[model samples]
Target: MTETTPYDADRARFTRQALARLVLCDHAVAVADGAAGLVATENDPDAGPGGRVSQAFQLIELAERALVSAVTYERERGSSWAEIGQYLGMDPAEAEERFAADLDGWNTAFDVPYRLDDTGLKRVPQLPTAAYDPVSACARLDTWAGNRLVLVNDEHPVSSGLTMAAPKP
Candidate 1:
């Protein structure tokens, strides 16, 4: 008789989320480059190969980060090397070695803690979004500008000056 292990809900969910994030990362670069019309051409030596090389590098970096994080999460959750290896389609030792450099790089770059502190769990960081209230933004702009109004995206240059004033009696 064959014994089947139940599907891991957490692993499945995390894998889905990681893939989504990777897609979003690539999409974001494409969108921004498209909007700016910053396509690299053969004529321009500075912007080589339609920015494809750079975009590919970015994608690779993002993928590495996600893979390392997921592996770390699995390890923290008490997943055995054999299980991780099976999921990665490799030998147990090879699986660990494959992710070693990426995991080390991630550890060096980010100071984020894997475990909870004495008080409680750490908060998840928020991703950037386009959502904003213009009213509040304008109010903040007014406060920042004060008496000297700075026109945004206008011909007139936005300037700031520091003036010394005598102490009031």
Candidate 2:
């Protein structure tokens, strides 16, 4: 048997993929907005306001990605998300959420806690929430963001300890 290899798709192919994604996105959004539930528009449906919004959002994000990729590749063509969104009749947030799941590359960009600039001001990205202090502990971020907080201060959890009893036989 012959071994299989991965196939690479270029810009045109990527663009077609993006368009298809937009139609699906619009369909999802459309189902949400109208008084008619999703079933009403099941088989053959018209994409209405929500669909229009999603479509615009998709174009906005596609434009943004194109501009970003162009800037990375060509360097002459460059634009920000805000600019692209403006051209697409949407906003920065809309453009962002349109490509929300596509935002995998910049994940670790904010992972570093602090940075020292030439001016010597330290930039810290993470901040403490009601659940846990960002100043200490790695576990806190997960714990805090995951559920409702029973204890609201540093002392509560830090001071918390379990009293051991005999294990049931």
Candidate 3:
């Protein structure tokens, strides 16, 4: 049998919940940045109301994506459909049915990590950029979390003890 390297082990341990959380974190960062931009433009004499409204609309879209990711994360963490449905004010079956496709896609991504580009020269990852590159995701997420959480101060604060080294080619 072949020896299992640290990277392989880490990758194996990176469950669907972890991937969903990474996606959520990425979306959260984008939403935060977009909100900041909207605030900055609020008082800018050169910024138009129409542009600010457009930016706000984009932020709303991002927030919706983040909500989806949050649901995915919760499902992966053993949350019951009823529990999730309660928050959305819908039946459990309806809630599950609504998110079924997204859940299926998330599961399928692991089986088919990437696809060829039109030229067949470049491979495009099926998972979100952060989830696809878990090593970088861990680092970036840890930094972001550490900066936000007062109790955390070290490198890998969020992903501490996780083996997130890049795989050997």
Candidate 4:
């Protein structure tokens, strides 16, 4: 049997929230870059429109993933399905149904953190890369949030603070 380290337990407790914030931060960065690209294109007469449209499509996909992560975070934090449904303009049952699989997968990742690869020599994490390696996710999300959120202190940003608050199992 594989033993869970103190670090592994801590990571399992907090990775979901960190990953959610990471996705949101990534989406925000991409949106900012897309806006800058649009401005640059506006000034250049030779710039084309198709690339921007494609970028917009990609942003939509990122936004969808961010939404899923947000829902997962909310569920983990004990938010009611009705509350989520209210915000999403859907029935509570529908909201729960829509996100059930995502929440299940998130929970399962904590239980089974990794699986043997096809080669049977390497292990692949069940959680998303950002969630699997939470230290990097915290650093990235905290830096991004610290730069953007006025309430987030530069020295101790949101994600780092959350890591400190991870629940003991």
Question: Which predicted model would earn the best lDDT?
Answer: 3
Screening candidate 3 with a backbone cut-off below 3 angstroms (N, C-alpha, C), the clashing residue pairs are: none
Question: What lDDT score belongs to each candidate, Candidate 1 first?
Answer: 0.43, 0.36, 0.76, 0.68
Cα misplacement distance, residue 41 of candidate 4 (Å): 1.9
Off by over 4 Å in 4: 1-39, 42-49, 116-121, 148-153, 160-169
At residue 46, give the lDDT of candidate 2: 75
Models, CA RMSD each: 20.0, 21.4, 5.2, 3.9
Q: Which model is ahead, 3 or 4, in terms of lDDT?
A: 3
Candidate 3 worst ten-residue window by lDDT: 1-10
Over 4 Å off in model 2, which ranges? 1-45, 75-169
Cα displacement (angstroms), candidate 4, residue 7, comes to: 5.6
Query: Tens digits of per-residue lDDT for model 2 on 29-125?
Result: 3333332333354633577658755655665565555443332222112446676577658897786666544433222222332345668774433
Clash count for candidate 3 is: 0
Q: Is candidate 1 or candidate 4 better by TM-score?
A: 4
Model 1: which residue pairs collide? Answer: none
Residue ranges of candidate 1 with Cα displaced over 4 Å: 1-48, 100-169
TM-score of each: 0.34, 0.21, 0.78, 0.72
What is candidate 3's lDDT per residue for 34-79, written digit by digit as tens? 8878766447767665877788899999998888888898898789
1-169 in candidate 1: lDDT tens per residue?
1222122222232332332333233334444444334354553565666566666566666555456656765664467778999988999999989877755644432333133346666432212110012222223333444433435443321111111123335
* Candidate 4 local lDDT, residue 113: 72
